[model samples]
Target: MRRADRLFQIVQYLRGGRLVTAHMLAERLEVSDRTIYRDIADLQSTGVPIDGEAGVGYILREGFDLPPLMFTRDEIVALVAGARMVRAYGGPAMARAAEEALVKISAVLPDTERARIDRTEIHMPLWVVSEEERRTIDTLERAVEARHVLKIDYRDEAGASSCRDIRPLGLWFWGKVWTVVGWCELRGDFRAFRIDRIASITCDGRVFKHERGKQLADFYRQMERDEAARDWAHRRSQNAP
Candidate 1:
């Protein structure tokens, strides 16, 4: 990294509320302890308030923020790339937020830097979930966050339809799609519902008793194991001589 880029990185790292030691910064930036100390001094000269104690390492002054120019070329490229990727695949709210953030970032930078970013566009393929499914997933997310029970009309893979009152524990994303992991009042068990398969949803306006020790990751793992077992059995039956 160039000296100026490394210096900016030092300031950004400190502004993130980390107690950075000379040795740690040296290893991270692939520089010597002397170089780290010099960069620290340069940042201090540029009005970055950094505090260092004997044993506790170095910290930036509370509320000390990095200047907009701190972003290196590569850092700006990465930010633009990530923002573009999110805008392409994420939901409407996320796409709009990423667009707003990119706009603000460009508005703050110099015209030259802004032109450089504009010239180097990053592109990614967009996800193709239906608008109806996207709206259903959005509604379920709100209900989960608000701790509200949901009354939903859902259909299963076997074409069985059911009306369910569920206390949503969390939303799980699997295979690039969304599902609701919740306690089903009708079945009296925890169930996972594909948001796309939901025919209708009504917020009951009653908060749920959150499940104990239930994590979305754990539920996904269990679902994966079950699917694997089913696939294995099907293969075994097909291969029987």
Candidate 2:
């Protein structure tokens, strides 16, 4: 999370008109208490009207009204439906995190006003992510965050097996499949390996330097090049036939 956003979130937590400790803020934001202390100091420096010491809990001063977040019934329904979709499709960790946010949103709403969210009428199909796939997604996410090199055993559509060392860069979920994009040491270029095709993956405990051509921006460029090449090839094949 960006520092500015984290600082705003701390204000929201304090707006409950209750004493919130720096440790509690740190836990909620997934940052160190020292970092929270620094953020609080930064907010106070800007005259945010937060009250308390580092050890004691802090509360927002009275009469500091944030413009109310006025949401209609339709908007609340959308938020509820979106949260349900995230819970159903996003990974387990993300699902729980999204639910926590929904709970926070519900906390301030009245019972009648919150009923639209409760009865959204949107139904999710009975589908679940398998253990293997879930683990692969989680592992790839961690690898990307840590910039760890991963050793993976992968099988292609033709059932040919190959081992690769990939500098984990990004992971994308496309409803049904998870794709892990990375710089392949063996290929000497960028590659997108399907999570399901990966028989095994292990973090090699080797962190990679931030190389220019291996960044996410470079990967996007490679994707554009691949799309253009496919279009040219398809046009040529049509002309030939």
* Candidate 2 off by > 4 Å: 8-38, 41-48, 52-68, 72-75, 110-112, 126-128, 233-241
Q: How many backbone clashes does candidate 1 have?
A: 0
Give the per-residue Cα lDDT of candidate 2 at 157. Answer: 89
Worst ten-residue run, lDDT, model 2?
123-132
**Would you give me the overall lDDT of model 1?**
0.78
TM-score of each model, in listed order: 0.54, 0.75
Report the lDDT tens digits of candidate 1 across residue range 100-203. Answer: 98897887787768876787667876766666776776677678778888899999999899999988877765646678888788987679898878999988
- The per-candidate count of clashes, in order, stands at 0, 0
CA deviation > 4 Å runs, candidate 1:
1-66, 69-82, 109-122, 125-127, 211-241
- Ten residues in sequence with the least summed lDDT for candidate 1: 209-218
